[model samples]
Target chain A: MADTVLEVRDLSLEYRSRRGPVKALRNVSFDLYKGETLALIGESGCGKSTMGFALIRLTPGTAKITNGNVTFVDGPNRINLMEMSENEIRRFRWTDMAMMLQAALNAYNPLIRIQDHFIDTAKAHGLNNKSEIIARARRLLTGVQLDADRVLPAYPHELSGGMRQRVLLALGLLMQPKIIILDEPTTALDILTQRSIIELLRKLKDEFNFTMIFISHDLSLAAELADRVATMYAGQIVELTDVFSAFEKPRHPYTFGLTRAVPTLHGAVEKLESIPGSPPDLVFMPSGCKFHPRCPFATDKCKEVEPKLTAYGGHQVACHNWQQVLEESQKAR
Target chain B: MALLELKHITKQFRQGKKVVTAVDDVNLAIQDKEIICLVGESGCGKTTTGKMAAGLLDQTSGQILFEGKDISKLSGPEFMAYRRSVQMVHQDPFSSLNPVRTIYQTISAPLLYHKFAKDERDARRRSIEILEMVDLTPAEEILDKFPHQLSGGQRQRVSVARALTVNPKFIVADEAVSMVDVSIRASLLNMLRRLNQELGVSFLFITHDLALAKYFAWEGRVGVMYTGRMVELSRSPSLIEKPLHPYTAALMSAIPEADPRLTRSKERIVLRSDDIPSLTKLPPGCHFHPRCPVWLEGKCDKVQPILTEMGPGHQVACHVAFDITGGGSKISAGTR
Candidate 1:
């Protein structure tokens, strides 16, 4: 088997607020195989985005990595990202793994032209030949179906939201990184623009053979893009499986609630069954399982005992009554 | 009587010496207890039309009729009454509700203003009742809590309850669920559907998300707008099943399917590299001609097409629709 492109083990992140340290993520573990797209899907405050930011060591000032390790496999060499020095991490950022942030319009410098941004990055890495760097940037733009001449001279503000996102995706691929982290890349664009951007990402992934960590609040989009899916609740990953299995046969109650909550074209016009309550407050999370407050299948044991993620049918789920829930979900289907 | 009618409405704002036509010669009829989804991309005049329907802005020409009465000339008290009957739920739940006010005050203030409730006690009771109607349990606790203490879903519920408190017949929900998480969006949509089924409230649901609109609207008519013109209006399922306009086809193709197994096969309709033409200086004819993928040789650029009935209840405004309909004759925009 090919080596894993990225491996995250026992990763926990905490945000130090005025009240106390809020455990944003707990024991989150996953692996992205080479050239595979892994989607981290969940509602807001589920720590999906937090996990993405943590992987890149770009957590906010309030957040701190409490425990865990992230290992990046570079060809035959294994690099421990968490232990890397600051300068080394900077050097590895674009060349090894790049990130396309959620807000593309804000990512670029407003005062500079698009081409200048690429020129600066290429020059910083000591690629001083201007014509060669320009050619590379143009090629990247063409790969994303953007007009090189028009986009290279326009300032970030001059471009539309869709065009700006395409430019950012082009920039992320410029270094020819092994993995690209897309954090809700199409969230800001309209439907038409979003479709184009997703198509571009799919095409680029096929051409460059890069692994992807796709994070989003929309499960349907994630289903369309990712090979495997992981569903997060509160601070932990409650379910992880292949995309088809995760959607067709979700084992966890939280996953079931989330999937049913999305309005689909194929589904009947039934009253959407929403989870009764909201997510637990991170500062004062419920005892035992953090999801017990909202889980309809919660029992006395669920309120008192935490469930570990256990393997079942080539998937991992963290629920005491996952089997019963799966059976019930199948009956409903 | 039609609940509301906008006939030949047009709006222009003067920026320096130039006039920006935001809404141009638009006509629409909204039926009672019906949900009309006005969908388009950003800056497509959907929100502006919604604002006009809610009496937030005045049309530069033509008339706005409410229940067969010309409300275009109504002012002061009459306009206030019109406004009370048509409440608006804004897009951003985070900033829409005041930070300091409790949910009770946010919802009850409208009740108090309209004198719908007898006193504070009655208003508070009604506030809690409205919260329950939106499926928000433990209404008393939520009533006393401020907006910041609630999540996006909770805040939106508060907004809906506030809109419902006035007993408005028509509600303009402009991208109401766009800001919330997807998990909560369905619940909110269900709540809206319930309200429509039970209260017989007419809705002008404006959103860029087409899937949500399809779920909530029955007999829903979709309006595809480009620039300041309505390109097409047709039944929901018919439009999605077989889109007539190129723009509609593109929009339908944009929706990401729920099943990952089915790959999207439609070729993406790539628009021109030029920016959306300025409203102040619209291209001479067919504002969409510059970006349209299948622009005809000279008809699309030289002459504009007026909205013509292609079939029963299906209207399209494009020169090519006739050619597709097996007619060679072209309709001029000026004739309309």
Candidate 2:
């Protein structure tokens, strides 16, 4: 809650489709504090990944940012990322803000050795010294608990999925960016491997103190790593609160449903109720609230008029029936 | 009597020259209307075991007995009967359902082939009934829709309905609900649970998730797999509460639950190594010994341990778990 590193305001994006423009992001607004991890949790097609791409201006050609701005702050310098020219933004990226895309194992060139990747990244960022790049890469790879000697000369395909993910993580931190956006970092990993990655991430965060935007659908990842949590549904931030508040006292019905839907590894066995229906179609979204059709507490107002995010107690929630949801959650407890 | 029994089943695949032992002498006996979940990481042979159990894949050795009859020895109608009685619902609903076929066609094919339906008219009626069984409302409308038109959850439900068309006595669902969204996963699981109870169909639910395995098999049993071997088997609650095998304990400890305070505060059982041993060149003795925290170096790395009964309905394949010597003390000291 101190020193805002990144401020995203009214960010909207749409993808060109034959049916129409698919509104992927709608009025997404959040502030990422320095040295804190903000997890953006959502199901597929909820624009969580899109928001990560939009933050670094790395979305596909079909996607167009319709409105809004991202302000990157570093000490006395404050720059609007959206207003920067293509070359300026290109230079600004990786050096100031880095993004580790989902399934980054495939992002590497299969022909090149791991060392070449570090060299290429360093050269792109204007760090030309070969010895310096190798030294930095060695430090990062060792820090991630990998043997740099074995990993450096091997191709991406030679490494296992977990090792490849760690290589990517090490590569992402090479430039020492102030902000790191990791998209589904531990997805597709085994339970033990995921735990190791989570532990490594926590250790790295503590050591580096870099602001992080962790995007994942797995609630466990958020519970373990996030300082703050954002629940995204239908291209909108439905809820934003501290990690403890979001899990223990969720204001939004979607968040509550998500928490209840997942069967925890421990604790008393309880009946879990899945939310009815699927995610809304992006091109032809439902009227009013996008989640109303599936919400158990939906009413006429919810079906007709969408609710804006309103501060309640200590967190922000975009729901017409937060009080009722709170009451229901408390009653269950 | 056991509905389906897999006795010392071993499946091997030839990757060019080297033989990959996918499933290594895994033994299991599934009771009538029982739910047994096989859980492990990728390439741990859970899927291969499921495929063998479903009668789709032939094991290199060992016997699969359906109703106490050797499935491999069955001929003509007997083989056909075994095939029809055991069905498989795959992990991906998108690819599993034929894109060209409508829900009605997919459902009716199995019914007509198996002679479960009297005529086309009867097949249509039965199709609707089966669709409704999976909670797909207005079965009439859903029957006309193609796989691409339905959501992931809906397509999965349609796949289940198709599997149910044959009236299978046993079902092998391999990561059945993993592809669907988290919010709809419980509904799919609940539907499966209901079918198991109401239809009296036994299930071999295979998944990588320990939590899902525990939830779905709470009343039945859970088996833990590592490198093509069954390392541990027990009732769900006891298995979760007190995992016997070091691998199972590591898996149980590694899982981060969907709770803030609990997950953060929970102690992790760190493995000695993170890499899973390759099936082609597996370690000499216990495949898990390389990564196991409580592994006895001289004993575990030399002689492979078989499933040894620890208690009532509980079995673990680890020398340290039984502790012929002082291995239990090392387990307590190494993990925390």
Candidate 3:
């Protein structure tokens, strides 16, 4: 909690669509401490991934950061990521900050051997000697529980889905950046493979003391890995707290619904109570609260006035009716 | 109560000259209005088994009896009618539902093809009622919209409605809600449960997720598949609470617990460091022996173990589980 590595304040992003501009991230703010994992969780089109892209100034297609302040505090020099020059930005990537992309298997070049990817990334970041790069890649691959002797010579297509993912993870750690961002790293993999990868990451994070921002739509996976969690709903963080607080006593109604929606490994076969109604149409968003239509506890005021994030007892929630929600939840428990 | 019986069902596909055994000799029976979940990872043959049951694909060497009659021996028109009763709901609804056709057309096609409705008006009414069953309403408004216009959840509901057009007696839903959003996934799962209870429709639900397979499903049995074989089968609650097979135990232990403190600190059953095996060229004898924790020496590697009864309505296919050599340390005390 003392050593803050990345501080994001009032980050807003937008994407240009056929209809008009779609607000993706709205006033998203959080602080990631050293060696901590902050999970950013939300449903599809909820700006979870967009926030990841915005942090490194790589917002996809037609999307632009309208306003934000992402301050990197741990490095020798304190710098705002957005205000940095293009030349400075290139050096910051993979040197100061690196990202393990979602569905990273498809991002690999099919034609090239897997070793070339590490060699090229090292060369780009000023690790010039081929032997030095190869040796490091071998060590990192071993760390990720992959055989470098077999994987380095194989093409991306030749490797299985799990192997490809491990290689991508190894590449993410090649530079040993201060902060590593993982976006849906375990998705689409088998449960066993996903478990191993999660374990491996946790082990590596403890040893290296690198700050990680894990982004996923899967709240369960996020809960397994993250120290703190920020639940995003329709372009805004609805609740931000430690994992236990978020799961046991969700301040926001949306967060509560999400927590109960998932079917855990061991529990009574309780009927999953789905949140009715889909996410609001971004282009023609409804009045006041974005989640009002789906919120079970929505009042007239909720529809008329948007509530700002307020801190109460260590948790931050953007709900006008957190008191009643907490009381009712506690009573149920 | 048993409605459909699979007797020694084995399905193989020809890839050039080599034959790939997709589904091995397996026997399963689905009761009327019963929900049976086939849970496994990719290449585990759950999907292949589901496809074979739905008549979308055929078995290479076995018989599938629908309502006490061999399905393959049915007459052409009778088989066509059988196809209507055994419907399939695929994972990707967008691809399953014709993109060019409206929601109404897509649903009514099955009804019309089976001659369930006398005229176009009758087909439309039946299709609309089916849509209403799936909770796609104002059903009349979305009737004219194409698959492209509908959201992933809505389209999935439409596919379910299409399957129910002929009032099918059984449904084979292969990862039906796996591709949809989590917010809407529970609703689809509820719909399937509703259909089972209200309309007396049996389901062979196929999914890679063991947890998802048990959603709204406590009364049914779960079959755990591994490398073209059903490794374990047990009552849903019992399977999860006390998994006997090494593969099932490993798979269950790998699940990320909902709570954070337990997730971080729980003693998990981590398997040995080995890649998921190739389905065609599987490991000898016991398919999971190479990665299993309770692996035996010569017995496990030399001879494949058959499904042995470990308890009432529970079966496991692992040599170490049953103590083939009658070792006192084996798991006889834990068997129910």
On TM-score, the candidate that comes out on top is: 2
Deviation in Å, model 3, residue A226 alpha carbon: 0.7
> Least lDDT summed over 10 consecutive residues: which range in candidate 2 chain B?
B324-333
Pairs of residues clashing in candidate 2: none
- In model 1, residue pairs whose N, Cα or C atoms come closer than 3 Å (at least 3 residues apart or on different chains), thus clashing, are none
lDDT string, candidate 1, A161-234, tens digits = 98899899888887888889989989988777787788788899889999899889887788789888899988
The TM-score, computed over Cα atoms with residue i paired to residue i, of candidate 3 is 0.96
Ranking by DockQ: 2, 3, 1
Off by over 4 Å in 3: B324-336
C-alpha RMSD in Å of predicted model 2 compared with the true structure: 1.4
Give DockQ: model 1. 0.60
lDDT by residue (B154-210, candidate 2, tens digit) is: 999998998999889999999999999999999999999999999999999999999
For candidate 3, the docking band is medium
lDDT of 2 at B277: 88
List iRMS for all predictions: 2.1, 0.7, 1.2
Better of 1 and 2 by DockQ: 2
- Please identify model 2 stretches exceeding 4 Å from their true place: B324-334
In model 3, which residue pairs have backbone atoms overlapping below 3 Å? none
